[model samples]
Target: MHLFSLTCTDFAAALHQGWGKGMFHAAAIYRHVFKQGNPDLAQVPELAQAGILTQELQSAFNVSSPAIAAMAVQEGVTKIVFSLAGGLRVEAVWIPMPRRTTLCLSSQAGCRMGCAFCRTGALGLLRNLAAEEIVGQVYAVRHGLGRAIDNIVFMGMGEPLDNFDNVAQAIRVLSDQRGLDIPHSHMTISTAGLTDGIRRLGELGWPGLNLAVSLNAADDELRSQLMPVNAIHPLAQLKQALQDYPLRKKGVFFIEYVLLKGVNDSRGHAARLACFLEGLPVRVNVIGCNPGPDCLFESPGEEHCRLFCAWLAGEGLFVRMRSSRGQDINAACGQLGGPAH
Candidate 1:
C-alpha cells in the first residue's frame, strides 16, 4: 500500500484490519508523516510503542515523494520539474504573493485538451497521475523543496477535471486537519469547461471549494476554435452547469480570460464576454497571453488589455488584470512543459 495515497480515515481502516488498531494510532502516524514531515514508517515512535516491527511496517507500506529534476526562479515565482517513475516528468510552480503563497500543480503529465494557445496541450495527453502521485506533489513541495504553500491551484500541465477522481482524492488527503490542513476554500480547480466533471464535483457538496473556468472566448465558434473542449461541452451547456453549481454563499466563480492579441482581445469580444457572463456571480481575470518559445499567438499589448478591462468594467462586471509571472523561466500561465524542456 502507498502510504501517501490513503487519507487518514482510510489509513485508519487499513490499520484496523492489519494490526487491530484504532483511529488514534493512524492519526499518530499521520501526525508524524504529514505534520512532522517524516515519511519513514520505521521512525514513527507510535508504531514502535504498539509492538509493530519496523521491518513489518516497511514491508506493508511504501512511502516516497517525486524527485526534483530541475528548478528555476524568476522574481519570486519558482518552477519545479519533478521526475516521476517510467522516466515521465511533470512541472509545478510556487508563486508567492503578499497575502498567500500559491502552488500551481499538474493533474497529468501532459494534456489532451488541445487548447490552441497553451504550451502543455502541445505535448498531448501523456497519462493521468495516480492519487498518490497527485498528492505527492504537495509532499515534494513542502518536504522536498521546503516551501510553505498556503493555497493550491490545479492549473498546470493538464485539465484537472479530466483526472477528477485522483484530484478529488488528493484534495481529501490535503485537507485533513491532521495532515497538510489546507482549507478546501483555499484550493481552486480550474477546468477547460468539462460540464460533466463540474456536475460531479458539485455533487460532492464542498461548498468552500473554488471553481474557475478557462473562458478565452464567449461565442461557441471562437471558443471551439481556441479550446477543443468547447466542442464537447458547448458554451450554453457550460453556462448552465456554472449556474447550477452550488457556490458557497457570497462566493464567486473565477473566469480566466487569456487575451490573445488580435484574436480574443477586441472590444467586441469583451462586450460578448460581458453578455455571456450576465447574471452570473463571477470575477473576470484578464491575462495577456504568455507567448512561450514558439507560440503562434502574440501577447496583447498593455494598452489593449487596459481597454478590454475598462469595457468589461463599464458593463458592471468585476474585472482584474492578472500580471504574468515566471515568463522568463517558462513557468507562467499556458507555458508549462514547453520548448524549454
Candidate 2:
C-alpha cells in the first residue's frame, strides 16, 4: 500500500485495524509524514512511542515519490519532470509572482483531451496517476525544490476531471489540517469543456474550490475545431453545465481564452465570447497562445491581445490579461509534454 494514498481518516482506520492504535496516533503520523516532510515511518517518534516497529510499517506501506527526471527554469517559472513507474513521465510547474506562488500540477502521465493548441495532447493518454502520485507532486515541490506553493492549479499535462477520483483524493490529502493544510480556496481545477466532469465537480459541493473552463472560441464550430471535446459537449451544453455549477459566495468562474493570431483574436470573436458568457459570473483571463516548436498556431501580438481584452471589458465583463511565463524554456501554457517534445 502506498502510504501517501490514504487520507487521514483512512490512515487512522488502517492503524486501528493493523496495530490497535488510536486516531490521535494517526494524526501524529500524518504530521510527521506530510507537515514535517518525513516519509520514513521509522523516524516518526510518536509511532515508536506507540511500540510500533519501523519494519512493521515499512512492510505494509510504501512512502516513495517519483524520481525527478529533469527540471528547467526560465525567468521565475520552474518546470519539473517526474519519472513515474514503467518509464512514464509527468510535469508540474512552479510559477512565482510578487504576491503568491502557484503550482501547476498534472493529473495524468499524458492527456487524452486532444486540444489542438496544447502540446501534451500530442502524447495521448498514457494512464491516470494514483492519489499518491498526484499528492507526491506537491510534496516533491515543497520538499525537494524548497519552494512555498501558495496556490495550486490543475492545468499542467492532462485534463484533471478525466482522473477525477484520484484528483479528488489528492485534494483531500493536501488539504488535511494535520498535513499540508492548504485549503480548497487555494486550489483551482481547469477543464477543456468536459460538461459531465464539470457537473460532477459541482455535485461534489466542495466549497471554495475554483473552476476554470478553457473556452478558446465562443462559437461552436470554431471551438469544436480547436478543442475536440467541444464537438462532444457543445457550447449550449457546456453553458448549461456552468449555469448549474455551484459557486460559493464571492466566488466567480474563471474563463481562460488563449488568443491565437488571426484565428480567435478578432473583435468579432470577443463579442461572441461575451455573448456566450452573458449570464455566467466569470472573469475572463486572456492569454496569448504559447506556440511551441512546430505548432500550427501563432501567438497574438500584444496590441491585439490588449484589444481583445478591451472588447471583453467593454461588454461589462471582468477581464484580466495573463502574461505567459517560462515561454523561453517551453514551460508556458500549452507547452508541457515529455522531454522528447
Clashing pairs in 2: none
Which runs of model 2 end up more than 4 angstroms from their true locations? none
TM-score of structure candidate 2:
0.98
Q: Write the per-residue lDDT of candidate 1 for residues 1-341, one digit (tens) a residue.
A: 98888889999998899889979989999999998899888888888899977787678887788888888898979999988999998999999999889999999999999999999999999999988887889899998778999999999899989999989999999899989899999999999999999999999999999999999999999999999999999999999999999999999999999999999988899999999999899999999999987799998888889989999999999999999999999999999995333
RMSD, one per candidate, in order: 1.0, 1.1
Each prediction's number of clashing residue pairs: 0, 0
How do the predictions measure up, each by TM-score?
Answer: 0.98, 0.98
lDDT of each: 0.92, 0.90
In terms of lDDT, which candidate is strongest?
1
lDDT of 2 by residue, 1-341 (tens): 78778888998999899889878888988898888888888888887887887798889988788889999888778989999999988999999999999999999988999999899998899999999999899999997778999999999999999999999999988888888889999999999989999998998899599999999999999998999999899999999999888889878999999999998988899899999999899999999998888699998878889999999999999999999988877788999994523
